[model samples]
Each structure stands twice: as C-alpha cells, then as structure tokens.
Target: MSETETIYDQIEIEDFTFDPDTQLFTYPCPCGDRFQISIYDLQDGENIAVCPSCSLMCEIIFDEIDLQEYLDQIS
Candidate 1:
C-alpha cells in the first residue's frame, strides 16, 4: 500500500482579496468556489486558504507586519 500526501500550492498573499468589512481574504479556487481565510486566522499565525467546496487548500505568503497594519486600520 502507498500513502499520498496532499500538497497545497503556495500563493502570494496579493493574489487574494482582502475584504475590509468581513476581514476575510479570498481567492478563486479551481473548483468554482472561493478559497478563504480570515484576518484573525492570519493574526493567529495561520496562512492556509481552504476552498469550501473542495478538499483543496493553499498557503498564503505574507508579511505578518503588513497584515497587522491592515488589521489595525480596520479596527
């Protein structure tokens, strides 16, 4: 038997849309749904964007400091 690991593609944070009102970052997934991650999740050191319609996820690369700035402005 062989085991396969799910590998998620790494994406630039700029590729995702940051909603100021909802504070959620979203990107279009190949599954026709959006990959989403919240600013609170990012603040907690999470960078994974998961598609609600599928078992696909990606890492969002971003600077923690820059994220904080956005959070601050919204707050």
Candidate 2:
C-alpha cells in the first residue's frame, strides 16, 4: 500500500535562491496560496513562511513536496 503524507510532512523549501537586484524570491507554494518571501527568510528545513498573496503566515519543518512541480511554476 502507498503511504499517506500528512500536512505536517508534505512540504519543504527546495529553492531559496534570491536575485540580488530584486532581493526577493517568489516561491510557488502548493497550499492554495503563493508566497513571496525574502531570500533571507528562506532557510533549510525551517518553517514560518510569510505568504504575500494571502498575507497568511505558516511554518514547515518536515513538509515534503514535489520540488519539480514548484520549480516549474517558479520564475
């Protein structure tokens, strides 16, 4: 049987690279919301994400996600 992933274990920060010119990285979040977090705020395995679109904040420590899916949407 396939294992089920819980909300607390289904997302993560794959890419946190920032553009020096913009100093901001718009990450594609799969939680029905988009996050435009500062590159400085993005840390490996760290949660507490600040969503710019919805303006809602959340965190993720062990949330796993399909990195490619988000990468495709990110620009």
lDDT of 2 by residue, 29-61 (tens): 556765555444443444555565554554433
Q: Once all C-alphas are superposed, what RMSD does model 2 give against the true structure?
A: 9.9
The backbone clash count of each candidate, in order, is: 0, 6
| Model 1 / residue 22 / CA error / Å | 1.1
Return the TM-score for each candidate structure: 0.84, 0.35
Tell me, by lDDT, which candidate is best. 1
On TM-score, the leading prediction is: 1
Clashing residue pairs, backbone N/CA/C < 3 A, model 2:
10-63, 10-64, 11-63, 11-64, 47-60, 48-59
Runs in model 2 deviating more than 4 A are 1-10, 30-33, 42-47, 58-75
How does residue 7 of candidate 1 score in lDDT? 35
